[model samples]
Target chain A: MDFVNLGRTGLKVSRICLGCMSYGDPNRGMHSWTLDEAASRPFIQRALELGINFFDTANMYSLGSSEEIVGRAIRDFTKRDEIVIATKVFFPLNPNDPNSGGLSRKAILREIDASLKRLGTDYVDLYQIHRLDPNTPIEETLEALHDVVKAGKARYLGASSMHAWQFTRRSIWRTCMAGRGLSACSRITT
Target chain B: MLPLCAAEGVGVIPWSPLARGRLARPWQSATTTRTENDQFGKGLYGATEEADRRIVDRVSEIAQSRGVPMAQVALAWMLSKRPITAPIIGATKPQHLDDAVKALDVKLTAEEIEKLEEFYVPHAIAGFK
Candidate 1:
């Protein structure tokens, strides 16, 4: 019910973001526990009724069904501009194609469009790296993400579950390049 | 990580704040379809179960004393952290959302916060590279 600025951005997001990883086609993804679309809709509706306007999902969650289901639910339950939708990239969706994942310029560019298509939105509120790509250089990833923001594909950027040094390195790179830094960072604090 | 994010003014949105439902219940008290089958979730806490169990037990103790659900206690603890902007809460059940929202109201005392946090030993980085 409470809204706060997302990092230093003027974009206000709900203090409780409804994570959409639990909603997808149960038969499609590795997460057998995922609720099917029929089961998932009520929770999304409830979250909206409870004033939760921020929703987080990933391009890989339920192999893209999560994004589809969430996209529909948001369209049915609320206005697109009223919600802060965050999703991540990385993790190969196609086992046959190594280009399907990571933070390379190719991967980032390709995945952003794929994610937008799946979510049925022209732009996402926040686009994030699901994890640091050891395979790709940080500058390539950062520049590609800067391009994403410049293209108006995403309003802000984020990274999840990376080392502090990796984050610091990316921050320094952003400063040097005079590019956009991350607006948010997600970590697993159990 | 929290300190650095705070200094840089980057919002910290923690995922799995309840540790994939581990912190929302008594230690090893129940198993959901997710807990039993989520390989990713299993990888996260398997190595540090002993330390995590102690933290879960403390969460349970505080929840009972406060007459609230264990999920609220765990979320209240997360909400107490200064740099945390929002916790990404995964809800399969409707009550999960209610519990997360109510956590905003369940403020913990400094002593309770200390008790909840004291058992956390350093964990090997599990979720990402």
Candidate 2:
């Protein structure tokens, strides 16, 4: 498994990332479905053995079961520095709570802590916006993410499910580029 | 998948070119794995439906005669199209993976490729709705 550098970040990950959305899947959603730990462990181990160091999960995956399994996998078997962990913030971990999810700084900072707790790590390799929130100003969102990195809670900030055309229209990520010590996700999907 | 990704620069990972084990028949996997249903439990592989069974038979004939797994032929055709980075190959057992990988080396002739497409045009089936 040849490792590909994720753009200019100097961080390299295998082309095949372990998408553990199946782990701890609870309810069957529209596009995403679920998978239990028993059915999922083989694939995760196989992916690692096959040289996949990138793991994609979210608070939404089986309502954080995916993160739990992934965190457990890394803690129980692999070293911390050997892999890059990416997770998203923007979905309601608690369906009943209106303020549990989104890109607002309060929400972003709060959810970052929660996601860290679920992932069982102090910092996430890449903390993504998950999806664009029209309600949260990009400045507020990026600044909050930068604060997390400054506090040593995260190394980088990134996003997923953003359409390419949407990325082209925004310059806020450019403001993110000018800062030191924080790199955003590459605009590529795998 | 490739076309979608290329237009978006999104990476392509195609899955189940074999119609979820339907391409090669006498499958060992339960129909549940082929297309797990909602609470209803009705699925593509459960009842030996007509259109699907015909597809299984036709693809099998092409693969057997050409000395390839039907899965490989189907996937190779997809890979042959542009922009796919990888296909999510699933396997219940070792042989399933073998069948998928074999298609990579098969290299269908232009004529054979056309014939396969003519036979199976990727029609939409029920239950997707």
Please tell me which predicted candidate would have the highest TM-score against the true structure: 1
I-RMSD for candidate 1: 1.7
lDDT computed for candidate 1: 0.91
Candidate 2 lDDT, A117-140, residue by residue in tens? 988999888777667777778778
What does the interface RMSD come to for each candidate? 1.7, 7.5
Q: Write the per-residue lDDT of candidate 1 for residues A1-190, one digit (tens) a residue.
A: 7889988778898889999999999888789999999999999999999999999999999999999999999999899999899999998899899788889999999999999999999999999999989989888999999999999999999999988887888789767977678989999433
Give model 2 RMSD, 1 decimal: 6.6
- Runs in model 1 deviating more than 4 A are A188-190
Model 1 chain A weakest lDDT span, ten residues long: A181-190
C-alpha lDDT of all candidate models, in order: 0.91, 0.61
The stretch of ten residues in a row with the least summed lDDT in candidate 1 chain B is B120-129
Best-performing candidate as measured by lDDT: 1
For each candidate, give its TM-score against the true structure.
Answer: 0.97, 0.64
Error of 2 at A142 (Å): 2.0
Name model 2 segments beyond 4 Å from true.
A25-33, A169-172, A175-177, A180-190, B1-34, B37-129
- Kindly list the per-residue Cα lDDT of model 2 for residues B1-129, writing each as its tens digit: 223345434333333345455565634435543255433223533554565555566566677887766777766666565554444454444354455545556677787667665544343332222
